[model samples]
Target: MNETISNSPHQWNTQELPVVVIAGYGPSIGESTARQFGSKGYAIACLGRTQNKLLDSVQELKASKITAAAFVTDCGDTRSVKEAIQQVQSHLGRISVIVWNAASYVGSDLVTGNDDPSEILNQIVGVGCAGLLASIQEAYEDLKAMKGTILITGGGLSGYDQNVNQIAVNNSWMGLAFCKSSQRKLAGLLHARLKPDGVMVGTVIISGAVRVGGGLDVTDPDDVATAFWEIHHSRHKQEVHLGSLTQLASEPT
Candidate 1:
C-alpha cells in the first residue's frame, strides 16, 4: 500500500481525498452538502430513491470538476441501504463522512390522525431512524478507521412540540415532531456510543420553516449545509439549533 505523508496538516491536496456519502440526496441540504464537501476536494457519493434526481446532482457536481457518483436506493429499506453502501464503497472507496438527510413528511393530521397510523409511523421510523441505524452499522468500520462524522438533519418541531403555545398553534405538527424527536435522540445515542471510537455524531436542528424563498427567519438549506460542515470540521458540538426560535435566549422549555 502506498500512502502520502504530510508534515503539515494543511497539506491535504497531495493526499488521496476523503469521501462523503450524502444519503437522501435531494435539492435542499443534500445537494448543498454535496457541493460544499465536493468543493473541498472530497469524493461525493449521492444516494437517493430517484435515479433522475441522483443523476442530475451527479452531473452538476461533475460539471464543477468534482469527483461524484450516485446510487439509487430506498433509504427506508435496510437491505437497500446496505446494498447502496456496498456500492458506494466499491465505487468511491471508504466513506469518511455520512450525512443522513432523509425523512417522510406525509403531512398527516395528528388531530384526526392518518387513515393508517401504522403506515405513517412505519415510514417515519424507517426513514428517520431505521435508515440511519443501518447506514451507521455498515459504515462503522470505515468511519472508525477515519475518525469520521455522521451529520443528521433535524427539525425544530422536535423540541417545540412540548411547548403548550406551539402545540396549541399547530397540533398537526405532532407526528413530524415525534419522528424528529426520535431521530435527535438516536443521534445523541450514536454520539455516546461512537465518540469513544473516534466517530463524531451530530445533528443540526432547524427551528423554523425551511424553504427556498422565505422570510429572514426561515432556514436556508445552504446555510444548513455549511453548519453541517462546520460541525464536522470542529467535531466539538453534538447539536446545533438554527433559525430565530432556536437562536433566542431560551429555546422552548
Candidate 2:
C-alpha cells in the first residue's frame, strides 16, 4: 500500500479505515456498486479505463462526502493492477472489500463450429479470470492482513447456452469454470494459510438480469452490489448465488 495522496478532491487522509475497491467502474454496474458501498460508509476506490467516467463517479460519491478516488487502471495488465492497488492502499489505508466486476466479450459461439476460438477465449480469460487473478494477487497480502473479502460478479451463464452466436457462450463458460476453480483454490488457501490472519475468499453469482423500479427491465447493479456487501458482512461467508440458479451447481460441502 502506497501512502502518497494526489491533489484530487476524491483523495482522503485516513488511518486504518476500511475501503472498497471496485474494478472496472463503468456507467452501469461499476457506478452503482461504488455508490452502494459509498452509502454504506465505505471509502471507494474506483478503477477503470475511462478517466472521465471514473471522475464522475468519484464526484458523485464526494457529493455525499464519501471518500472516493478514481484510478485509471487496465485490469488486463498486471503492472496497472499493481499500481492501482497501491494507490487504493495509499489513499484509503486498506481495502476491506474487493469487487471484481471487470469483464470482456470477444464473441459468442456454440463451440461446435466456431471459426476462431482463440481470440474469444483470450479475451474472456484475460478480463474475466486472468484479470481477476492479477487483482487478487496484488491485494492478497493487504486483504489477508486486514481480513478482507473478495467478491467476483457473475451471471447465470454457467450452464445456459442462450448466446450461441457470440463466442462468449463458450468463452464465458470457460471463464466461469476458471472463476469457480479459482474461488475454490483461493478459499482453500485463505483457510489454510490466511484464516489465522483473518481473510476470507468468496464469489457472488448473479443469475439473471436485475430488475429496477417501474417494472422497467433495468440491470440490478444495486442488487449485485448488495449481494457483494452481504457476502462481506455475512457470518457464514460462503459463495452466494443471486437471482436464479436452477441449473448452476451448488457449492461442495
Compare the candidates by lDDT and give the number of the best one.
1
lDDT (10s digit) by residue, model 1, range 1-253 = 1111112223222345798988888988898898899888898878887877777777777778777777787888888898888777765678899999988775446557446778778887899999889988998899999999999999877774346236523545556677788898899899999999999999998876677654666888888888999999999999988876533324432
lDDT of 1: 0.78
Give the Cα lDDT of each candidate: 0.78, 0.65
Give TM-scores for every candidate, taking all chains together and pairing residue i with residue i.
0.85, 0.76
Backbone N/Cα/C clashes per model: 0, 11
Q: Which stretches of candidate 1 lie over 4 Å from their true place?
A: 1-16, 111-114, 164-171, 212-214, 245-253
| Lowest lDDT 10-residue stretch of candidate 2 | 163-172
